[model samples]
Target: MSRAIRRNSLTEQATDALLDYIAERQLGEGDSLPPTGELAATFEVSVPVIREAIAALSGIGLLRRQQGRESVVAAPGATHLSRLLTLRVAHAAVEDDAIQQYREVVEVGSARLAASNRSEESLRELDDALADLRAVADDESLHAADIAFHAALARASGNDLFVLTIDALQPLLHRLRRRVWSGWVNSGGDLTSIVEAHATILERVRERDADGAARAMTDHLAQARLGLDVLSGHVGDSPARD
Candidate 1:
């Protein structure tokens, strides 16, 4: 009745064992991991194997390589997720479609949280992001504001998971926004409309209208997607789109 990850190789097993080691010790962020030799001895593996596992862990942002060639536990963050999302969007796999869908769900939840839990400082931050959006004279500046505003909104949600998810989605969101905005620009959708949609979401959040905030976010994303010429997946897998 033991359902466990079937370790297909020594390195795979060592990776799992290292995760277990961290969990068992309740290692806090920045806590020093056992020395490479100690870990190797505990796992009954060569130092090379332990080093391999540590490398893998670092790649995923779960472990930090400190100065003086030391390793420490790391607080989970979005760096790994951001890299993977950037690659996934660039490759345009079928699963890439699901990421857009996943974002909608996460962002809607975040919007509701922002409406319910936002602080005055968070509202001011949102206002600053909006002012930046209105001041943008070019698509590039608009895109920068677009990224910042959503990030601010997520932080206002008072949920760490929401903040991290929004952070990780930044690159992909930027790509999608660029694509959508280009099509919208050619088709007569103006930056003012985009700014207005976001303003509605912000106003709802400021008013503490949770339902209104969620609905506003959903509508905003739908409109943004609608502006895209075609929902093409994969760069070369499909015909070139505008």
Candidate 2:
């Protein structure tokens, strides 16, 4: 047995220790969690507390329950966060526009860093993602491709924190992307223009022009925001989202 957890904070302390255990072992997605009994012994906490900690981690998408009997580490993604963001936006505690603007600011910086630090493999990934974007004809596929392209750039920035931060925002991004893209398609907007915007950013990344990449991304998002506004009937006079 190890240090006994205080009764009042047992679950929280065990949760932190569990996270540390995973990190110390460098556990990745799909890795089996050590048994709860073992964890209880390690933390000198009751099995109930260990279970509580597991439940909390699972709720955050850090862990997954398999067959309702086993727990596994989950792959890093925005799966659970999307719901939380959607609900928060629905409740009006946070404005959707603010979230979109935040993404623009963060992505602009990420694009600049990507231009400077992107590896050859990352460059290839960007190329592939863009290629996939160009091939998708439907709005849904296009939205997915768009998100993938941005995610690729985030990873290319060579900053894991940036990548994770952006990943967490994907749900909201996808929401806006889908709405704007579908509206554009319905309104007879040109898909080629959207592809070209991504291409411009990719070209700057390839040329290692950080300023150009950042500027291209800024312009792209500005256009997208305009389009989203039009879709929501807020820009009846200005047609945007090209």
Candidate 3:
């Protein structure tokens, strides 16, 4: 018999062991797990290592801990995922050209999915969100409505992974929107222009034109980037010739 390789590090092993214990024992959310000391001894690692593993999982929303009490397994939610997305986008923004390309790809894919999967009810919801956005055009309320509209489009994609991925991206999207909107307001760029862009995208989605919707969304994002760049004083409205 061949010996098996230990492919995991001690911290990973500890985390997996705890997770398996939770699953095998049918521990639901809010249920207390074993003490860290006990788990460390069981895994034959230092207590601090186990604590570090627990902390990592906790940061991802998979566990929660209280000082002097046993840690508990918790269901993951969008909050931690949102934070992760924001960090990812902020890091990407440091390399603006590369980030813009990636953002274009994601926006196109999301628009196609929205066109293909959106039902009448979901489309209506999107329309309602768009109306709300128009109503709140000059205020913070528009930003919230804008987020809701995008979220609804993600949900309409009919893929749980797509929905979750977009949900995770919400924080970054919100931050970008704030920057863009503020810049637009300051530069005297009409908010109605964005509304019209969204309306055009929505119409394509309603018509089930996946390619058209995708193209529309890409154009909208490009315009948004222009507004943001102008606001940040990084570039003029006119694009430079290559």
* Candidate 1 lDDT over residue span 1-242, tens digit each: 98888646788889999999999999989899889999899999999998899989998889998767779999867878888767776677634346557767888898999999999999999999999999998888999998899999999999988888789987777777887777666666777788998999999999999999999998877656555534442333534333
RMSD of 2: 6.4
Extract clashing residue pairs from model 2.
227-240
Q: Which ten residues in a row have the lowest lDDT in candidate 1?
A: 233-242
List where candidate 2 sits over 4 angstroms from the true fold. Answer: 1-10, 13-45, 61-77, 80-93, 182-189, 236-242
Candidate 3 stretches with Cα past 4 Å from truth are 1-13, 16-42, 46-52, 64-74, 85-102, 185-188, 232-242
Model 2 scores a TM of 0.71
- Global Cα RMSD, each model: 5.4, 6.4, 5.9
Error of 2 at 185 (Å): 6.0
> Candidate 3: what lDDT?
0.80
lDDT of 2 by residue, 50-102 (tens): 99999999998999977756699996456576666667777986655687688
Backbone clash pairs for candidate 1 read none
Candidates' C-alpha lDDT: 0.83, 0.84, 0.80
Measured by TM-score, the strongest candidate is 1
lDDT of 1: 0.83
